[model samples]
Target chain A: MTDARDGAGTAAPPSAREAYRDLLPALMRADDRLYCLDSDTGLFDRAAFAGVPDRYLNLGIAEHNLMGTAAGLAASGKIPFVTTMATFATTRALEAVKIDIAYPALPVRIVATHGGLAAGHLGPTHHALEDLAIMRMLPGFTVVVPGDARQAGEAVRQSVGLPGPVYIRLGRSATPDLDARAAGTGPSAGEPFEIGRAQWLRPPGDVALIAGGPHPVLAALRAADLLAAHGVRAAVLNLHTLRPLDADAVVAAAAGTAGVVTVEEHWRSGGLGGAVAETLAERAPARVARIGMPAAFAERVGGQDDLLGWYGITSGAIVAAALNLISGTPGGGTDDPDLSRV
Target chain B: MAGRAPGAPGDPPAADLPAVAHRVREHIVGMCAGPEGGHLGGSMSLVEILTVLYFAVMRIDPRRPAAPDRDILVLSKGHGAICLYAVLAERGFFPVAELAGYARPGGRLMGHPVRAVPGVEMPTGSLGHGLALTNGFALARRDRRCFTVLGDGELQEGSVWEAAMASAALGLGNLTAVVDRNALQITGPTEDAIGLEPLADRWRAFGWTVREVDGHDLGALHRALTQAETDGAPEAGRAGRERPVVVIARTVKGRGLPSVEGKVRGHYARLSERQAERSLAVLRARRRRAAP
Candidate 1:
């Protein structure tokens, strides 16, 4: 029996990895220039991968080598999709990502799996709570954290067409499907989903919850529903892209809402929370509350939900933060510190 | 067709290799002794290897440095960047006069090689990255050949070994790496700093076809590098072979200039105008001695 949390034989929504597996055949047929650098993490089924021997390369367990190889391939006119665990790539092969991929602005899509705490009970070592912040720091890098397998798939496809290096953060678990929900009324799904653009899951209201990554966006959607039951009006914005952050969306959300709450499965200092705060502070100053992890390392290990709950990144926490902001008394909405600042 | 026999009609002459190396070394020495004090020992030792690649072995058009099929070289020991820049200039990838702007404010010649330099395939100064990069080029197009030069000291970096293993595993016969096995590093002798004595065995164990050669010996380097390009991957283009070749090039830290040759002091110097004059004189004497 594999724990849904430990990333083996789990029944979650189709993840970015599965989406990639589905999209790869059509993508290969469409463009023969595409290549994959699997870090030998069993990212794809052996049969599907074997059919395209010349287009794929297994870079073994060495993550930095994946980046280096991707650099060379990109230099040589091949579009490489370098895959690895987010923790290893963000922290372990960071220099390679910076020098080899980012510095050169290579058209390499770093589709990082096991992003955030998606590795769950495997503990902090497997978690990638800071991958987005690190990749966002790189100049000319496109940082994306898709909200569902569909959005994740869409982000990957969009990355292929977009120029330069792009880091697509993916969760290890099967997240609940939210694309259909995101595509309906609130912000109008008619707008073609584009990189650096945010999707609206709910209409404008007195308060808005801006979030990124699968878990956080789902939590924001659920939090919006809970807010509605309480007769509170809240808008949910799915911020898939972190760099070239949809500042226009952020500004509009701030302008319409009394206050804004930014949620993510990462540290409050530099992840999606920080990006929102930076945008709101400069573009539209509002009473902003950050719903993210504390500035501490993990000492407790449990399933993804327990870990997310322990860190106060939940629908309950986000709703509480929104209520507090609406009441003009923004403090720690969760068990941790009140990160809201006026 | 790229595999021209040594004395074939259209093949380039290896005789001028030493002369080209001598001139390139002169440029390197002058740059190192200027405002940009550099990795002098490593740069001087690399002249012959780079000369052979650019002049005698590599198939590149100076005007078309970015030709899709041109052979590529990555200098993994990036501290020795002036040597690569000097050679690129002589190869006509850029103007020889641009050498004057090296390390100058707003100059493209950074302390390390950057893509801004026309001929530089990839910017590298960080150790243990070039082999992996060369492997990438090899995998991208099996037809396009790639070479990288690594410092023996850089062998200590685990990333180099990772690339070595991957190259062999992927059967990248189009890729060849030359390790500039100069005994010393920035701190001191590599043995004293961190021993990589069983280096050849390590590469072999990592599944590479290792060849030992004198890095400073022009004829040996020309033969080794040329043979690697020509003999590389006949079956790879046909039946798929998994042997990536690595030439371990043993060299003195600074093989030219008598005063600094083999001396740790030769590793770096911001020579005063007078010292620069003296270094130029030594190169001139060597050129005079070898003149026809």
Candidate 2:
């Protein structure tokens, strides 16, 4: 289902849309067992989710209403999945997420689509670069960014049965299939990966590498090859759940290796790196280098690769940052404040 | 407390309303005093309306609040919570003694009405949320039966307008929004805070069957409620449609207690024990004068 485009026009990824459609039946049939609250007429689009369906509610563009309603439904003993765009759900409906979902411990799976720069033409109004930062800040919220269509489906399936609040970010396009080598290996590859744990895609040694979000998986793979060529034995970590992060793994890797390199599509401050830094500081603080977009909104718009490179979140950038950090030399790109006090 | 039509002043001998109102007021005062904090003025304002709704208009079973057929009442102005707790307790939804725990630490009776509390429909301290939830309940019972009470001050929220538009479009006749036009909010007079003077005209413009009544007048209130019950006949019969009804009830910020009645400053003002005592005395005198 991967559609390789040499930097072109914007269209809904066939795989993403198909996954959403396929999941509709499971959502509807769950009945009182599963409840979904959405902004706009999310229910009207599918046959399964339609018109005041007993277990579902359409809050109509009111993101705050959607979160609060989802909380209310959860309070009434129903598993609620609140669907909305990442930009609006993270930035606009943030308070409701904090007070109602996280604070009250409502079991709501926030299925946020159009994550990062996937919202192409809509410009700054739709771009969700800060979502990871915002989401990972809240306590008890398990943040998951599926790398592709298969991961998205798996994440949704895993999230449905999970307890407490789950923030799932899905990409607009499909990526390459999950590497068969990584399957059935780690704890995450086994019977339903635990909520707060990270997956080690490659073993750690001289330098440690960490990435999050759908785009991060590709960057990690590419960066690993680059690091190997430079005679650096790099271990790649997929920081899927950002909030209740796998701090133990990150600290152990950082403590054993020369240094740690963190990368994400979110702002340098308050994103995945900030979360890891805070965790490590409290438990096992270490010398770490952060790699992400600088603190500024994206004004340029184009294809995913162009956006990635334009924001300096490319594999080459990650490779360079890793080299500098391991060599005990601060790269010019290392400008983000030390988040030890987060 | 169930079958009477709020007013039938002559039929039930006007005497019954005060007795019920007095009990409700007692519960309200006792609840707040226990916690040392509550919307005393707001609760006082709605004592008569709640009495009438429970005693006369609404068809609710004390044994079953969630029973599919029971009349639904949502108190959108959640700050005026004591009135609801008092009325529900008197109706035997829970032990009347539960009112004593209100607002106190280690009490099931929260400052706001939660679902655990019998007869309290939705959890709403937020002003705009209740009307929307009430719209859901009303639309659900489109076959016939549900009522929501919103505060005039709360109607200012934009979400209330959205719910109003949707309710009118859905034609939910089974739903009736009774706005306690007591004209007071936390800050001061509702008009001074946020004008809702043209509130009735606004509801009518939204395509609802509007009825204005003196909230304190048990007779007018009974007639209005009965009118709402009949209004759903045509819409429910139509199947694909329903019309929302709005009852604009004009009431004093503090109705029965002369010490606080019509006082804008008393919207959320606290009363000293002496003032509480005087207020109770005034209510007893009024009850005595109206009795026989």
Model 2, span A1-342: residue lDDT tens: 021221222323545435754675576585445766657734235456554266555667777656655664564456777788898899887866776577657687898888877766667787788898888778888898765566667777777777788998876665554444356533445334445677777776688788876566567666777788989988777777786777888886677777778888777888888877787778876767787767666565656666666666767777877888778886554544333311
For all the candidates, what are their Cα RMSDs to the real structure?
Answer: 5.2, 5.9
Q: How well is candidate 1 docked (DockQ)?
A: 0.72
After the best TM-score superposition of candidate 1, give how far the Cα of residue A333 lies from its true spot, in angstroms. Answer: 13
Question: Candidate 2 on B1-292: residue-level lDDT in tens?
Answer: 1122223222332347767777787666555555365787778888877878877877777776666767777788888888888877777677776787887787767887776787787666767766665665554444545666788888888767767776665566777888888888877788798798788778777777788899888888878877633354353333556567778888987777776788866666455666666766776678779885
List-wise, what DockQ does each model earn? 0.72, 0.17
Worst 10 residues of 2 chain B by lDDT: B1-10
State the weakest 10-residue window (summed lDDT) of model 1 chain B.
B1-10
lDDT of 1 by residue, A124-215 (tens): 89888889889999999999988777777888888888888999988877776665655575765656667898888887899989998777
Q: Is the docking of candidate 2 incorrect, acceptable, medium or high quality?
A: incorrect
Predicted structure 1: lDDT: 0.80
Chain B TM-scores, listed for every candidate in order, come to: 0.90, 0.87
